[model samples]
Target: MEEKFDAIVVGAGPAGSACGYTLAKAGLNTLVVERGKFPGAKNMWGGAYYGPFLHELFPNFWEEAPVERYIKHRKFSFLTEDSALSVDFTTKKFDEPPYNGFSVLRAKFDRWLASKAEQAGAIVASGLQGDDLLWEGSKVSGIKAGGDDLPADVVVVCDGANSILAEKAGLRGDLSPKDMKQGVKEVIQLPREVIEQRFNLNGKEGIAWESLGTFTKGIPGGAFIYTNEDSLSIGVVVQLNALAEKNVKANDLLEEYKQHPEVASFLKDGKMVEYSAHLIPVSGKAMMPTLYGDGILVAGDAAAMTLATGLALEGANFAIASGAAAAETIIEAKKTGDFSKTTLSRYQTRLEQSFVLKDLETFKKAPHFLENPRLYEKYPEFVCDMAEKIFTNDGKPREKTMKLLKQAMDGRISFLQIIQDLWQIKRSI
Candidate 1:
């Protein structure tokens, strides 16, 4: 089709759809070209959808969007071979009107968000993967897909992790294995009532858990369990090089994780329903690519914008927010009839101004800190050993805590090493 659009969005994810929806709603001719058979047909997430950002674009989204549950509690457990040290936070505040966040299946959510864009007049066309951006004198002019060229004044590539377009456009360099994370997750099924009673969830209120410490077999990765209505999303995220070097199968690690005394109980009656895995970039702020260039802007995972080291993993929120800012920038450029590098640069400037970039910048060292090996290996074993000794009652003589601590430290780590770890942690976080 020999046609042109005001903007073309690549990838029908949160970021792409948000930009498409905003531009279309503002009456800009927008086209969303997705590679998948349908929007979100191939996306996988722990299924957490933070609300306000979506609500800002589609008010009353909860009433229309396919949501699994409104999260009421969050739990993080540090697990060892046979034990777990955990922390939990629950509040009814999340149950109120403006809910905090909800569990979501990316398959349904991505389609729905794209549909919203379609509803707002954006032409969301699927099965057309944006192979590359069409250039006009050092500036992006449009996109080429499936032997057909679709022209656009501005192109927003929300192409997700392993973005081919970003590299083709010289927006990102080759992604190193060390800079990526391999995530394997399974959706396990159970009767709703059984799940509700077992997890202490009433109605749609659910729990989320992130685990570390020996879960990755001394590898720099972590495990997690997220509760849904009648199923649970459980998985592990390991740094690529860590997993490759250990020659560990992600499934095997998952099996061991489920065998842990703390994890076993949760899977007692649950049956595996679906298996999924994907790689995410999480080398911290250093891995993020240049956000924009002449006539083109990148958002979402394509830009390596997810915060993997936090109380909760954040990708969708950043995706939508950056997408919106990109749309805002495009609108300004459109008004001025200038899609030049100088005018389009507002995309980068605004992203830096937003909390998405700021937070990613702030936690820049967090991924490296979390990958320090000790947090998941040495400290956990040490902590579990201390727990065993402190709980033992038939000791010949009660040992002082300091003596026990030093003894524990002496084996694999030293006092100076622990202190240095502490210092590095303080500096990173």
Candidate 2:
């Protein structure tokens, strides 16, 4: 006799683990399958997880999770070749219980999250690839993994940005370079005290720093530095289409970002311990796939659940939220013993009612706004130059602030262009 489960979750990342944990805890027999040697073994991100969904699932999870630090400080910088203009914000509120965000190493965190599912009675099968979806007529029945047909009532596709299972189920079509971003990252090890001193952090409080400017060589993405317990997660993310048009490699851009004066200062004496790269689905609703089908649902990057508003970049929270919603929908369907499209459609309804779809819809124009070339090129240069002019001591006579602003915009942009850009920024973000 063949074995069967109530649910089979593909990809043991945040989304898969959350769904599996939720289902198993709800008394449903769940199975989580991963292609990597272990959960998160092949995962990489900018190093921070935000929002309150995780706490809702596992209260005070940070108390036992492999989290590196609670992020209480955030900084955004606009950089030129040798100068940088930054906005830094820190607060004690973010340091309290149920902290706003945390810096985590995916390899450790993913395994820990998967273990949570296992502890909840879900059978987490790592090193097993979910090859394809088993179907009966038009409905998904289970998964084909490691040459075995593992039958299940419902299958949740939590695979990463390139999800073969979702594609095969006709949930998402081919992803275009225009809708994706390539991220290259490195984990540089440093002493704990040294890291705290350099980043101006205390205890487990950390910082997330983002930069946009010449470092990307006019690419549409940006650079980020996240503080960890004894390491720094630093990297560069760029739009795939823009990178190709400029004929530049993502890794080469990352190397250039590290060599920037302001960036180099933070990584001085740090030893590189790990290097990784991954793709990000950044187009929000524009690239979103069909969320649900008969006996099938997609969450996480597979469904383009990431948000990339100019002011913030988020994904983990959305992934976890979608996972929870999917689990709830499945649990409800289980009660009726009907795993058809009509029953599973509740997954989309749940997402729409939650922040997952709501936030994405609210910022649906962000992707188009972020693609403006001047944002990655001319704006940073103009801002830094304006700052230099305003603060220079060698000036014979200091000009008014508006005059300096005009000087900065002289050759780079026009007043009308600034107005237009600001208007778009307001509309999008």
Candidate 3:
């Protein structure tokens, strides 16, 4: 394993695979080391892969990739105990090529992506975990994995949200539970036609649904359901600190979410086939680690590159874009034969110039805004209460919508509180 390569990519998820594929495509000797038995074995995501980043790397990827469905609509649900309120957006244009987004199973998706890297001439070594970083004084020289030190001129660390190698290399400090989230999901098996019928989806079309309210026990988190080809990916993401404070297990919250009438309807007659959980960094760019150092670059979740902007939960897109940016920087360094921090700083600059950083910066206040308890508690309850009033037609004379809105707000929330919440939303968004 002492064989040196032009670049070594640790973690074969989207970010690592993208970096490996790009470097190898440029004829650089590249190696990908994955800790899992195979790429995506331990990876889990909420299902949608957004934007044009992946298309730039692999045009017509959906044609050959193991994509489950193309998302035709985005639905947001607000819930109370017995009631559910939602908003859905569907565009026919999104159904065309280079589609809006696709529902993916990470295990299958990552393997296909890793295979693409192999096809592009990168060596992929799976079932190998990087124990520590091999360093030359202040520079990262290679990766120490499975009792062997594999040398490389530059190392790209995309080792997920909880990255030990980044810490060992002094690239970042320990992650705080306050800044992370625990996500628990179940892949429910159902016939493809059955799933389509339940979700109102057509051929290869799917819906991405997210909900907020009593699901997480008033915790500052939410639940999601993404339609797959023959199954449904349903889960709940709860703030780690809130989970601890409430002394509730993530699985318990997911169970309660499943029992909700709205959620139960979707899972009717569906059998649970797989259960998985993960930790996600939700702190946006404020919690990000140094993007690059001498001979080393960190991309994807390892650098806290996830964006939770209320409207959408984005990770794969950031991971792929960051991986490409890191590869571009390394290619430049290889041309100059210098892997110094000064030259590698281009990785950060490239990310900044791209949508990866621009989008993150745009919604930097999201994490903090999400922390407000009112969002997951009072606001959803109020909205559902208002909806109940408006829709429940009684024998008596009907009241105006504005009157129902006032009735819903009265006693529960004050005018000042409403104004403050509105002001915060305006400022944060």
* Predicted candidate 2 versus true structure: per-residue lDDT over 323-397, tens digit per residue: 889999999999989999888888988998999999999999999999998999899999999999988989497
Q: What lDDT would each prediction earn against the true structure?
A: 0.86, 0.93, 0.91
Q: For candidate 1, what is the lDDT?
A: 0.86
The TM-score leader among the candidates is: 2
Span of ten consecutive residues with least summed lDDT in model 1: 305-314
Descending-TM-score candidate ranking: 2, 3, 1
Evaluate model 3: give its lDDT. 0.91
Instruction: Evaluate model 1: give its TM-score.
Output: 0.95
- For 1-429, candidate 3 gives per-residue lDDT tens digits of 357899999999999999999999999999999999999998998777888889989999999999999999899999888888999999988899999899999999999999999999999999999888998999999999999988899999999999888888888888999999988999999999999898899999999999998777878899999999999999999899988888989898888889999889889999999999899999998899988999999999999999987777889989998998999999999998999999999898898889999989998988888888888878888999998898887888998888888999988788899898788788776
In every candidate, how many clashes are there?
1, 0, 0
Please identify model 2 stretches exceeding 4 Å from their true place.
none
After TM-score superposition, the amount by which residue 7's alpha carbon in candidate 3 deviates from its true location, in angstroms, is: 0.7
Top lDDT model: 2
**Candidate achieving higher lDDT, 1 or 3:** 3
Query: What's the TM-score of each model vs. the native?
Result: 0.95, 0.99, 0.98
How accurate locally is residue 126 in candidate 1, as Cα lDDT from 0 to 100?
95
Residue 175 of model 3, lDDT score: 90
Which run of 10 residues does model 2 get worst, by summed lDDT?
A: 390-399
